[model samples]
Target chain A: MMIISTSYHIFVKEFVSEFRTRYALNALLMFVVTTLSIILFSIGQESPSIDVLSGTLWIVIFFSAMSGLSRTFVAEEERGTSLTLRLLVNASSVYIGKLVYNFALILVLSVIIAVSYVLFITEFTVKTFEIFWLTILLGSAGLASASTILAAIIAKANTKGTLFPVLAFPILLPLLLTCINATKLATEGAFLVEAVKEFQILISFTVVMIATSFLVFDFVWKD
Target chain B: MKTWLKIAVSVWLTGIIIAGIAFPMVKVPQTWYEFPFIPGLEEKARNIIFHVPISWATVVAFAMSMIYGIIYLRKKDIDYDLRSVSSASLGLLLCILATVTGAIWAKFNWGSFWNWDPRQTSIFILLLIYGAYFVLRSAIDEEERRATLSSVYSIIAGVTVPFFIFVMPRIMSGLHPGSLGDEQGKGPVLEFKMAPNMLMVFFASLIGFTVLYFWMYSLKVRQMRIERHVQQITETH
Candidate 1:
């Protein structure tokens, strides 16, 4: 209980720090806009319907999440503040803090991408709000597990920038697989039951990764 | 090298002779030569001889590397790290060999060398993941940090190997051979005469490849240790 609540607070604080020190979100916003503009341009005046919009939005979300992850846990190391974190917080809490911050960031990015997708792409709007929100919820949480865990791994490495992607991609494959499917279903305006298996898998992926991160973060931090 | 390897060479040569001449003559099932194996698998049996052994050998190599990685972490010994890297190199070689052989076999069987099937894609992904581990190691300087990070990466990557090799394939559907688990290269496989003699040959080959892996791993560690000494001496001078 103490671990969960305290970590949640610390996560918010670290997120604020990430916003200030890293300017990660600002850079990511630019990347997102550039990506969409390129997609729109390359798409060549043939306005991509809602289907293309959903894919473009997810792609932006994934890349921004990945780039943001490279900086996720490094702020503590940058300030030599890991020791302070270690002294006060359980290692798992620190991981949770990082996880929560990453989840929030990815979720917000998804929303921005979603809105941009609607504004820029087509007349197609999400028909059932539940499907749209559910896809976002599962996809965001799933992305957090892959991003935050990989960030912890890369944060400890000598070359965080290079190693993070190599490590993250393999781990993220299954989650990405499910997220794509879920998004597909939502885009097609299918009922939740139609994509139930993919959603269940997404949920399981999120849980297992978060659980493994909790266990593995202890070693990642102590080392 | 000759004087030192006399016993090993003699033993290997003797095993080859016995396997090539006597065993196949005596114990193989008569029907093996009398009939075809599973309709059109006759020619492909030759592939099993190379492919299965290589994959089995590579899996052993990966496990050896992983063990050394754990040892390096446990002892903080660079010698073990060298062994780990060398074993990984061997594993990578064998993995590539298996992929190639598998691709050729697929071209023969499935009518295409490359299909974006789950099995094919997952194996390719695993290959990239390990290749990237080497890239990650080379991107950094400082032997200690490199050793530590590479060792860590190897451990993590090695863990994922089985996840893709066994678990991922089972999770989805695919046309990859040896996928049925129990049917992997046994009974009426490509090597028709696999009765008693081929089994012996197969097992012997598995053992022989394991020895080769250890020999190369030892040599690599020795070279790394010498290089470390040379660097240290030059620095002191």
Candidate 2:
């Protein structure tokens, strides 16, 4: 109970500071717009298949995540606040807080991408809103859970920018596969029951990732 | 380190080498209609003798790496860290060997050097995950910090091994042979489709490769410990 409030306070603190600085926000939005525009221009005037659109959507989310989520711990280390954080809060609290921040940040990014996909790609459509939304939301959480500890790990390294995505790609591959498949199903008008298998896989992947992160984040966070 | 165990491992390796080659050739006539294997793989299935063992060795190496990584974190001993990285490095080597051998086999059977088969994709992802571990190791300069961070990263990466190697492939259709509905139309893998002699060779290969993995792992761990000692002496001077 006490841990929950402490983590919530950390999240609130992160949210306030983020709105003030807006570095991650700016980075995420710029990445999304630039990548989406390039994709829009390069593939101009061709009606991409639902599969292609689904794949492209995930590519955009993945790269945007690379841009924004890597900053979660790098910001602390750069500001020299990591020591202060270590002193002030428990490792789990810090991890939960950053994880919540990342989850919210990516959720917003995913929503923006979904909306932008709808607007930019005229033929792009989701036949099942629940599956589409569910994939995006759960996928965002899974991505956050996987990347948060990695961000902490990379934050201490020298070539952080290159390290984050290289490390993240393999760990996130299964999640990405399921999410892309689920998205494909939704776009192809599959019902929730029809796509339930993917949903279950994604849920399990998220659960495993989150649980593993919690188990080990203390070591990564403290070190 | 026991002398008899060492002798046993060496003899096992020798036996595997001879049997892996000779048994496949002599166990049954290569041209017999009585033989049971995927028809095309009848001869080239010999690759399975080396290929399956190496892949299984890779998995064993990885599991050991993760186990040692957990120990290093708990004990915070540098030797544990050394064991962890050495096992991972060996795992990466064995993984590459499996990929190459599997690819060579694929070229003969699948008619292409590189098909985007489910099994192939999973192994490729495994390559990336372990590849990133080495990258992570080299990117850090402080010895203790590097050990701690890499251990944590390896643990995180280890969680995905089952997904990439097993669960993900099972969910998708692919060219790789599996228990049911394998792309090659080979039914369940463990059924009577396996000849008695083939089963014996398979068990021998599994045991032989496991012993071989442990031999390589211990050798690397000892080498790393000596290097660390040398560094410490130099620092004292």
Candidate 3:
């Protein structure tokens, strides 16, 4: 549909803008690497099971993603042109654009994280590794949707600086829970059939959040 | 200054006081507690007395505030906006009370006041989300912007509250009740086992909290209205 194509185009543009922005990509990579190293050092040369490292992988990815998300709209304010951008598009469009862009960023970051998690902490078998990738796909979609909406809400506020994550994390709690559970089950080689409920919960959380944000975002977006 | 509203509140308060006095004096119909309570659970039955009602009432209040927020945002009416915030503030108050009571209940039933279990942790997160909402409101200065932004945030934040509270912990490995999403949960059916007087206590709390929500909501609307009138008069001179 026209709507989908429009959002996809906007989403691509949003990604290019963010990718060109300095520090977000680099800082996220550094944070992910640092967290992996820290966990490796903490666990030592001892071969902790992949099961143990799985949740940590998602946690660090989430926090790093969160750190980037915390800055999403704020940098625009300092430059003083954010108001122009809002004037240019539908408010809901901005949210969709930011969400797709952030989703892609997190997906890439999570893959790199999975790789580092394997190298530094545990030897993830190919099977568990693939599941880890899928979990991140689901989880990152969730993280992106949550942060993008909250980013819009706080975009112009006095505390635009801090409101992003404080409002987001609590909302993201269930997604975080689901991602961890799915990763654990998958690492242990439990059948996807067994983890169906957890998967459903994550998917439902993503769908509901996206729908709710779409409906209420316009009335609430402040200039 | 409304005679009927004052009389209603007094009557409600009197009923609440009487219910409070009579509940403990009356014995439970057949004590679910007549059996041996586990190490921390002698008071488990008492949780139904406080926790469930408070959360139910708070969620009701929060939902009402959400409706007002939508109305205000749609109309840009200042009175409706103030009503939204006041109702939200009342919702937040009830959220805190619900959380504390749930914590107390958790201590008795789960043997620890804080468990990373889904139900307890999720509600705590709900409280946190709403707390941050208040923080968001207070940080702003312009009444129009503040009310507009917060009303929007409230609806968004409201969605997150239930998502986190009811969904997250169960999906994760929390050791709390209601996480499994099954009919056969661990606790006794919270609504049953009333001493008629205890039911009275429960209903009384519900009425008191509801009335309190309305009273605070009206007061906030009146205050904002007065401030607007004062501004208009000063400008006229």
TM per candidate comes to 0.80, 0.94, 0.82
Which sections of candidate 2 miss by over 4 Å? B23-38, B165-171, B183-192
How well is each residue in B167-189 modelled by candidate 2, as lDDT tens digits?
A: 56545666665534464545544
Best to worst by TM-score, what's the order? 2, 3, 1
Query: Which residue pairs clash in candidate 1?
Result: B45-B190
**Tens digits of per-residue lDDT for model 3, A86-144:** 67766767677777887888888887887776665546543555556667788888888
Q: What is the interface RMSD of candidate 1, in Å?
A: 3.7
What lDDT is reached at residue A214 by model 2?
A: 94
Cα deviation of B134 in candidate 3 (Å)?
1.5
Interface RMSD (Å), every candidate: 3.7, 1.6, 2.1
Better of 1 and 3 by lDDT: 3
Query: Per-residue lDDT for A1-223 in model 1, tens only?
Result: 9988989878888867775766887888898898888877887767566655666667777777888778877766887988888888888888888888888888888888877876776644666567777878888998887677667656766667767767767766666656655666677778867777776677777776677566545656776
Write the number of the candidate with greater DockQ, choosing between 1 and 2: 2
Pairwise TM-score winner, candidates 1 and 3: 3
> Which numbered prediction scores highest in TM-score against the true structure?
2
What TM-score does prediction 2 earn?
0.94
**Candidate 1 chain A, run of 10 with poorest lDDT:** A211-220
DockQ score for model 1, please?
0.31
Best by lDDT: 2
